[model samples]
Target chain A: MKVNYFISDIFYVCLRDLKHYLKQRVRIMATLIQPIIWLVLIGNLMSGLTANPLTLKFLDAPSYLDFMAPGVMVMTTLFTGLFAGVRVVWDRRLEILQKMLSTPLSRTAIPLGKIAAAVVQGNIQVIIVLLTALMLGVTFKTGLAGIMVILIFISLFCSIMASISIALSVNIRNMETFFALMNFITMPLMLTSKAMFPVEAMPGWLKFIAEWNPISYAVIPLRTLVTKGWDWTVIWQSLIILCFFALCFLAGAVFFFKRARA
Target chain B: MKNIIEVKSLSKIFPGKITAVNKISFSVKQGEIFGFLGPNGAGKSTTIMMLTTLHLPSSGTAFVSGYEIKKSPRSVRMQFGYVSQDLAVDDRLTGYENLFLQAKYYHIPNQTARERIKILLNLVELEKRAKDLVETYSGGMRKRLDIACGLIHRPKILFLDEPTLGLDIHTRRQIWQYITDLREKQGITIFLTTHYMDEADSLCDRIAIIDHGVIKVLGTPQELKSRLGGDIITLDIALTHVAKIPRLIKLLKTLTNIKQIKTAKTKITIVTLHAESMMADILKIIQKNSIPLEMVMLKTPSLDDVFLNFTGRSLRDEAGNREQAHKARRMLRRIRS
Candidate 1:
């Protein structure tokens, strides 16, 4: 809540992590390769398969690639977030996290700032994936604002994940334990979300689970933005859920964080 | 005199029924050096977490630089620099970048940030390694960068939690020297915690000894040791003569000049209230007792002795078995998910 300190810590979070990431250019490039492969090889192979089945006459014409695009985008966000939380874990181990925590930076700034950096990184990845998708014949459906739409998707998912990451990072006091729990925590959550498959394709319970998953909201407006044209109803409803998750996650993270000191 | 840091009845408890810190009280005078001395898990780190506004305490309150830790943490953090034991410095970044990031955390203007980073680099003796990735540097070099990062903001007070830990003895000396020099030159109030008695003895003006969530003692190095009211005398009797120690201790305590006596199997140590005349008297008793000693020495009590005397355990012992550290990480992942 302290303006000067929070304002500065946000920049602190971005620049330090960015510089660290920059030095590992090879790793960054490697991480980007996974999503690029999905955009190219998978999009191409699955586009045909997804086309007819993904579209129903009542739902309007939706390309298989288009239907899969948002899912993939959110998947990128999800995967990117998976390790981002670990960055905090790494910070905890190396004592770097202690240095950051001790400074004049806000508790809110630490997580939000890192999340902001992830958003920027996520935006970059989304752009590359979008470009590759475009080359593979995926359309944006909406013109000129493709970049803007990509940024929005990045913010929605990054904010949600960043909040979750910080909350856990503070709580998790060690590294090996974090590794052991990853299967239980991150893997199941990612699989249950509607990232790679349609909600209808899922069984009843799973469909219900997907609907409840926050990532489902991330994909709703995102899929509409990429395919089947933009509809305010789906767009607005998706925005509401995403926003609710963002606020809820952040509030919850801060609250627990406050208790941790106590 | 203004107390730059004020803590009263501060306590923290983990949900798992572990008392990390009990109600403790202390304060730091502006520009003064205050040491928080404790073995690992004595809650030194936990206390620092609360002071720096990183972890919110479950009970009690603290004020730093005139701001309450609970009510105005952001403002409190702004006025201080907190260097931690966790080695927060990123290995990929050069020394300068680390400080630049710290400057950003303090919200320094860009023009000033550049100059401040340069100044801090020189202070930690990393001016030469300022551009190298920390990953390439030795442990000592990385530690220096971490110190430089903490000082970039020109904070009036600095909180250093075990700054010299994990360093070679020589490197520890260098850092100790650097901190003393900085304190004298800039008049920065330094708040530090350490398991190293020599670190507290050499660097701190006063210290608070904590163990098992309690502050057992608080005084200057000289004051704390002096409070025992004697010169510490150690007699290294042979292991075979271990039984002779108890009788010797009884005999030694009977000396008019000696105040307290204790025995540790093969070694008999005594504290003499009248230090000047007591050694000769003590030497006479060993001769009379026919205790052939391997070595005999007398000096002020080190921090280790103070700790062992108080806690009945060594700090190094608690540092063992880090498997639970990994378990803590798993719990972290679960909570996050």
Candidate 2:
């Protein structure tokens, strides 16, 4: 019975967030439009860079769109997951969080539910990105199984990003400050990782940073599944790393949420 | 009736060593409308937070419906409904949805939650707007919905931290009606904190006047007023004449009919046996001293007088400043959002 309540608490929290997300028509429009712009414009624009035989051989993909689609899907996830904490900040400002805290619901349920909502949203955007890529003539090498793997990668990556966002938001009360911090962190993470380019093409120092970047672990597996078939060696290494980071950040998020103050 | 809430020297000192709620002890009787009356920053909300299990006490503890707040917060939380000072209802959700979400927080089953939401929407008179998003709700309607959300679980006690702080007078009175009905109809004990004197005097069965993190006095409205025991002559002086308050009090001290004199801001309250008979002498002294009196009125002792007599300041004066600040902050938040 106790476990039942805990699970229901998480469900309701996630449900409320989804309800809010669905109500904002403009936000939904923006979410759909953003990934399409990146895929159609940036994907085509960067395709020229990989047009050379030498570059194509190094890229090991039929087209630039195939290599970049997975990166763009993870990028969308990155943006959504990082901003998930904005809701927590707003809830704190409005005292909705305090009201929830006063309830009998477990504190861990709050952040876990928010992470769940972000993962769901991340998957929705991933699907949209994938369909757009498919419409743009990008084919997956691993077929249906690869698509499922990509969804799992996005969910794990989103949970990691969202957990960090929420953990920071629990301490930082101001929305402006949270926005500044998210921007500072997101730009470095997105550009330094192999999201938009091949890490092999990056300079020595940048490649080192990209290899160490957690986001690359997520994007690498996704790119491999899309461009090169299911290579278990590469997939397993990145998957384990993603799972470890997800676990650590989720534990941190729950810890901060339990101590959240109005 | 037994005590529904028992706070024993509950104190909260923030990290900076700022004591928000000092060692204050009070017991609220079951099925009673108990008011925590104080100005802003007087530990009213802190006490409520501690009782609601949102903030851990630094040194002492409290119990709600026999569950200790610190040791068993979930059990304590299960017993009370909390309506915070800010509007905590989700604007994106319909009124029904808001109440349903609250019911889910308490683990109320869907079937029971729907039934409770229907009854609550009707009770709060939001039946017409039940399906509309709360963003469309007026200030009063949103507050009513907030109160209904608090009641969805049908907890034994309800904690309202300034439930009507920003609403207009009409809406404030309407909320008061709902609060009274909750106690009378459902026998739910209510613990509310407010800076409004009229709200406390009219609605609360018992009032605890707190100031600077301490409870100065606690009693029923009548008991507090009768403790002052006589008529009161209040003199409101202009801001320019604030310095003259000392002379006015000194002069009024000479009158045999006047028992005690208190000065808060620019208002001088004189406790006397017969205010009407003492009026002539008071006016003569004011006129001679050229104190520039703005207004004068003589009436029986009220909760305002009781507050002034204990805290040496008028509740209305502090509340007026706080109300302005509260409204400004709310306006800024609305514009920014």
Candidate 3:
């Protein structure tokens, strides 16, 4: 019976957020438009650099669009996941958090439910990016199975970002301070990783940072699935690393949430 | 009636070493409208927070519906509904959606929740606007919906923290009617906190006046008022006759059943057992002396006089800043949206 209440708590919280997300027509339009701009504009603009044989060999694909599709999908997930805590901050200001905390709902379920909703939202954006990439002539070498693997990676990657965002939100009360800190963290995480560029083409110091970056773990496996199918050796190593980071960050989020005062 | 809530020496000192609620003890009878009346920072909200299990007491404890707040918070939480000072309803969702979500949090079954929601929406008179988003609701409608949300679980007790703050007099009276109706129809005990003197006088069965983290007095409105022990008669003479005030005081002292006399400027206040019977004699004396009388006013002791008698300060003086702050916040919300 106790376990049943906990599960339902998570379900109801997630359902509320999902309903809130769907009701904003303007936000839905923005979500659809964002991935299309990144894929069509940025993907084609960088295609000239990969036209040469050396760059094509480095990219491990015939064209830049094909190689960058998976990276774009992961980047979209990264952006979506990092902003999940904005809703929490909004709820806090509006006193909705106080109402929920006063109920019998468990503290852990609050952040978990928000993270779950972010993952679902992230996956939706990933599919949009994938469809746009396909329309732009990018083909998946592993087809349907590879698409499933990409989605799993996206979910894991999004959870890590969402967890970190929620942890920061629970600790920081000011909305402007949270947004400033997010910008300070997000750009470096995205730029230093292989999400937009190849790590082999980077300088020695950046390669070290990219090698240690968690985004790279998600990007590497997703890129391998998209460009070089069935490479279990590379995929398994990164998958394990992604799972480990997700667990650590999620635990940190729950700790902060439990200790937060209304 | 038995006590539904018993608080024993409860205290809360925040991390900054600021004491918000001192060691205070009180009991609220079941089915009674108990009020905590105080100024803005008088620890009223802190006490409510502790009882609602939203904040852990730094020391001491409380029991709600036979469950200790600290030992079995989940059980305690299930026993009462809380409506905070802020309007906590979700604006993006419909009124029905807001109450449905609240019902789900309490684990009410779906069919029962629907029926309860229907009745609650009707009770608050929001049945006509149930399907519209709460953002479209007027201030009164939004507050009514907030009250309905609190009643969705049908808890044994309801805690309202400034339920009528920032509302017009009409809306405030409407909210009061709902509160009284709840107690009469459902027998639900109510614990409310407000700084409004009239609200405490007219609505609460018993009121505790708190200040500086301590409760100063607790009694019914009539009891507190009568404790001051007499009617007040104030006579304002013309400035030309100010010199005769001392003589007037001496003459008034000769009257029977007079308690105390005080003078400031041209006005003299006479506290007596019966102002009605003494009015004729006092007027005849004033006329016989030919002291240029300007005005005479008589008043029975009210809750304000009781508050002033105990706290040595007027309640309205302390409430001024808070009322302005509330206005500024409301203005900011309006500008933002």
Instruction: Give each model's whole-structure lDDT.
Output: 0.74, 0.88, 0.88
By DockQ thresholds, what CAPRI class is model 2? acceptable
lDDT of 3 by residue, B1-337 (tens): 8999999999988775778789999999999999898766678888998999988999999999999999999999899999988889999999999999999999999999999999999899999999999999988888899889888889899999888877889999999999999999999999998868899889999999888789999989877876898888999999998888898889988999889999999989988867889999999999999998889999988788888988888877755654574665444333322
Question: Which window of 10 residues has the lowest lDDT sum in candidate 3 chain B?
Answer: B328-337
Candidate 3, DockQ to 2 decimals?
Answer: 0.51
Interface root-mean-square deviation, each candidate: 3.4, 3.1, 3.7
lDDT of 1 by residue, A236-257 (tens): 7777778788889878767665
Q: What is the TM-score of each candidate against the true structure?
A: 0.77, 0.88, 0.90
In angstroms, the error of model 3 at B12 is 1.0
C-alpha lDDT of candidate 2 relative to the true structure:
0.88
Deviating ranges (above 4 Å) for candidate 1: A1-5, A47-63, A164-170, A174-227, A230-262, B1-7, B26-32, B57-66, B227-229, B232-305, B313-337
Expressed as tens digits, the lDDT of each residue in A186-240 for candidate 2 is 9999999988877778899999999889888898889899988989999998889
**What TM value does chain B of candidate 2 have?**
0.78
**Position A248, candidate 2: lDDT:** 97
TM-score of 1: 0.77
Native interface contacts kept by each candidate, as a fraction: 0.91, 0.92, 0.77
Best by DockQ: 3
Q: Candidate 3 DockQ category?
A: medium
Clash pairs, candidate 2, are: none
